[model samples]
Target: MRSVPRSAEFRNGGISFWFRELGCPERRAALLDTVDYDVCIVGGGYTGLWTAYYLQRADPGLRIALLESEFCGFGASGRNGGWLSAEFAGSRERYAQLHSKGAAIALQRALMNSVDEVIDTAGDEGIDADIVKGGMRLVATNPAQRSRLHAEVGYRQEWGFWPEDLHLLEHTDASRLHVDGTIAAAHSPHAARVQPAKLAVGLANVVEGLGVHLFEGSAVTEIRPGDGNARPAAVTEHGVVRADHVIRATEGYPVHPRGQGQEWQPARSSMIVTEPLTDDMWRHIGWEGREVLGDAAHAFVYAQRTADGRIAIGGSDAPFRTGPARDDNGATEPQTIAELWRGLARLFPIAAEVPIVHAWSGAVGVARDRCPSVDLDRDTGLGWAGGYAGSGVTAANLAGRTLRDLVLGHGTELTRLPWVGHQARAWRREPWRRIGPQLVNGLYRTADRRESRRVTRTSRFAGLAARMAGREPHEPGPGGNAPGSPDRPGAIGEASGAAGPE
Candidate 1:
């Protein structure tokens, strides 16, 4: 559905996030006031649209409908950091412990391959996603961070051999990239970057092109089972449509009222974009207009350069909130901007002086274990998928296809992957979910300080250095599919045999 474009005079307000450029909106989509469809989706963001797109393509005659609350591109999908990185964000060791090795590998393989899937989609849709393909680089901030990287390398090897894509960049070269005195940095060609908003809009365009029914300004308030061959119907504020199957693709909005344990916590992560850099600044920083970069700093700042030439740096700094929150997520703390500026100065002094041109923040439904969840409701034949922490660009692409396959009653290697239904332990109702993020946020701050004080590695192979750090100490717990029983929702994965021991 078309929305009146937000005026250019509008300011960034309390937030400071800026995303890739996407053009004009169209007239609002007409509501499906009547008739029955095979399936109904609630949410017009990337995950919802992508699921509808593939599902319709896979089964053409199957009538499908997607309803968006506002105009498309109004959520995190259009307001993200625009990093299309392929390297999984969750620790590799955790992956080994969470899923069966084979299933983990398959899941990782699908996620890794989905990088190309985005590129292909952009190409097929004739959308310029501003994809830069050189790779993504992970810079280490302290000595302990080195161990984590080495451990990840070993664990990655343990699971399956990846290409020799990981490059161990040391000192002088590291400093050249603004990461001076860093212990070590890992570079992988497998990762890529792109313009986010244009991609989301392009996805919406493709969904419409496929002749699928996508309604904007339609927020589904309820889903009730229908009679006979017609499935349950999705009712919205404006109108309603009867359908056979309903897919609750709402990530931020957890509409499962009675299912307290089936909740997904919402988190508010923010970003800031600098004014276009001076030409001299770019030559020295030498990302060479390629690759997104993040350091092993416990704070985990991820930065990428935009096609229009601004630098977008994003980090988690606000209290986590549940449901679709754009403004109420909290404001940008002055201290955070100060800390981020210091970080930028540490790497690129010249770029630090550039005035910040834009800033904004959005919420993501992040699970405690830092992985997305794909759960199903057998009684209603309803499927759910969300909780992607922050790596949703590529993960959502793969998840959408996987979600589609699962909804269509097909089995996939992705279905058996460790992450699908394996959510962390539940928070007892309210106040806890709100308080828990601050707790985790505190841990992250402490961890960052801890990492900074650790020693730096001197050589690529200091003979014994890599060996000690690379040692595979112990196997992580419950890494693969638990075959015996379907777990009860809200139970910890470990207790349910869906994850490693607590």
Candidate 2:
């Protein structure tokens, strides 16, 4: 039974619901026989499905198969906020270290391209995911964040690239746009929104069309790596999948560590959808922006309106325990979801009247450096992708192509991304990984405390002071997972405006 009310009237009159059609049907556990292929994907989410689609497209003759523990899109792919974005993990300095600039650019470009690829793929494959293209908005809550937003645009210009759909907003204009506490706003067309479940089903459909075998309900219990000429294989409840390469595509709740402790750490994220609002309510808010928006909150909160005219809000910075499981839908604890609900309601007054129609939680992998990993264990033929941290939608598609190119010995631009070389294996066991999140959250909380004393937070000194008070400043640390330190989250002013892609 649900701890909270599962069904209730939302702020607006229209009701809201979640996408229930997830996973691929062909991969169901009712397998009649075993099969072998050139590539065996151990997941059915975006990474696996996209990889299979691209791999088959590149070479129709290559034998590829995808195996999912549940159905396709059973994880984050189906339940996410439907954010189709190319936002970098954190910073460019991090990017430069991941791979060559060309590689990084190519990597993101491929993901950006997948936005269209996904839309077209959905239509062509007869999967209706309610894919919509409105653009994405990032709202700044303060001047400091406003400055950060400007710096980002400048940095992108220096990089000699900016998405055609980038825009910056001032406070006066931002305040009138609809939402409150908005000081600055940024816009970009490179991002998009989609119906989560349909995307997975559509992509899976496309892969199946290409003769790729898909197995659903085939939860992989173990993975056997390749040795010498032997290929890698995934052992599932239904049967065994053998292939030249085994790709682990589960993003949020990724599989157990393979070779290292930094392989993956599961972090729970929660979200709620409201009953569709009336047109008059929308007009009262005058939110014609029709874009996804995230604000500068101590705990990151992003909300977007769906194609069906309902609001989907998500919060990720809630305190959580690692490796904990929720409903199959992957929601966080009840209190956490309630807190996020309150946050959402605070941002939009109409949310009070709009009852929360549906709520769910899911998990994602956090690497040591807080980046995703695309590694191919040549010794075992067990290639995998994980640690997307928070932003994995667009990255997942590119990861799939990269994995395929690496497996096929094809040196394409897509494969040259820094993602392949950036591995965060064995992070949870790492001291920093284990203790870093807690300390960072605590520092953020402290900053929040200090900022609360004043009207606004200003200066790098303040951010520094917060960090200093929270953690002992040490030399730059390596990227990997370890337990995080317990500290309150100080408000690290956010960049309210969206800038050019990193």
Candidate 3:
């Protein structure tokens, strides 16, 4: 095991470092009585908040109420790795299977555009989340990783990504960033680094200012689809919120409702942030552009340079917690923290001595097919958008707009995207759910270790894991699992639970 700095503080399960820096916002009053509205959106994270923002903008007169179990952004929204990239959460080929390859390509392009949309919205709304459009860099530190990096570039090109969207970097260009042992790298301009909590809190205030009712500390026990005469409703402890349209926007943290329990499996990802670095340390690091960073490893690591000069890095070193249990408080294991620290040290030796100030973890929603979806039942007046793996930061925005279009009965370009109404199969029940992720994670970890030991090719363990997961080795999903499996690339986690109402 790698050595960890003993002086570092451990603040596990305290929400997250982002929330701590921003100071948790004062909670909005919980719902005290039943209410009626044109729309009731459960979960006040990015998806629900953005949905309310767009809906109110489209029609100011529409009554909208957003319910949250905790304060807005309390879940993955505030706990993510702060990457607003154009990466989608599902398989491109899988999305193409639902529509045409052209349609899937369009969806990818739309996500690329959504990265800008989020930046522009933050500016328009005066939400200063330290937004910086420095782009993203995926570095290859080993020969095996280099092979996968080039393969990913080719994969993107085959799927219609223009050169400007993503391209290879020369060794000199890759060295400019100064990540240790980087032999090759890929760059994409369609990404930004953000102070995630600031954006979530600011957006919450913006929607409330727009006359959207936001009720924090309001946990919805269940969501019921409307029948012939009844309207869709979000049943909460205080009261039932009935609306013409009810949207379930909970990602990862589902309040399970009936048969939908296994629809999304919540995966827990852990993170650690260092104390602000010194000026001398900064010079040695050479990440002046402050672009978000990732690696091509199967058990990948993701990182970002905070505006305050701290380095926040994360990975899926922790095993998935089985059953419906979740680490809602952002608790991280000591072993997980040590593993993440080693990753940081390996990438930037300068960070080895820097004391870690905080560590936390959060869950991300993953569909069995490893794709995200946005859908509404016009007949039932019910809708939902989640299963982002770990790419919810940008995908949530697109989902919000798509949900708005679906709610308003609009047939715009956003609605025609392949993920708009796509539905992935449910996760397997119980023992399988518990066994599958553990097995896959173990395989990927072994593959990474083998690659580190100078294996010049992608390990067979990774291929085997991909096949076990019912995917090909060339098909990358959300979080980094293997070549063809569905998993989050950077901000990934592991856990199991029933899909419940938002």
User: How do the predictions measure up, each by TM-score?
Assistant: 0.80, 0.82, 0.94
Q: What is the C-alpha local distance difference test score of candidate 2?
A: 0.59
Off by over 4 Å in 2: 1-17, 20-27, 31-34, 98-106, 155-165, 170-177, 256-262, 324-329, 430-439, 442-453, 458-502
RMSD of 3: 3.4
Which predicted model would earn the best TM-score? 3
Could you give candidate 2's per-residue lDDT for residues 1-502 as a string of tens digits?
2333345442211111345323234445434356788888888878888888878988899888787776777777766677766555433345655665666556556656866766676677787777667666766555544554555454444432364645576666565447655666766676666667677777777788789887776777777788886667777766777888888787555555345443666765667777778998777665565566665444456677777677777755345344533335443456666756766665776655676777666666656455566878777787888666556676676677788788888877765667766765464444654455556545444544444355354333335533532332211111111111122111111111111010
Give me the overall lDDT of model 3: 0.79
Worst 10 residues of 2 by lDDT: 493-502
**Pairwise lDDT winner, candidates 1 and 2:** 2
Ranking by lDDT: 3, 2, 1
Please provide, for model 1 over 43-117, each residue's C-alpha lDDT reduced to its tens digit, 9 standing for 90 to 100.
777788888889988988888888887666666676666767554533345566776667667766776688788
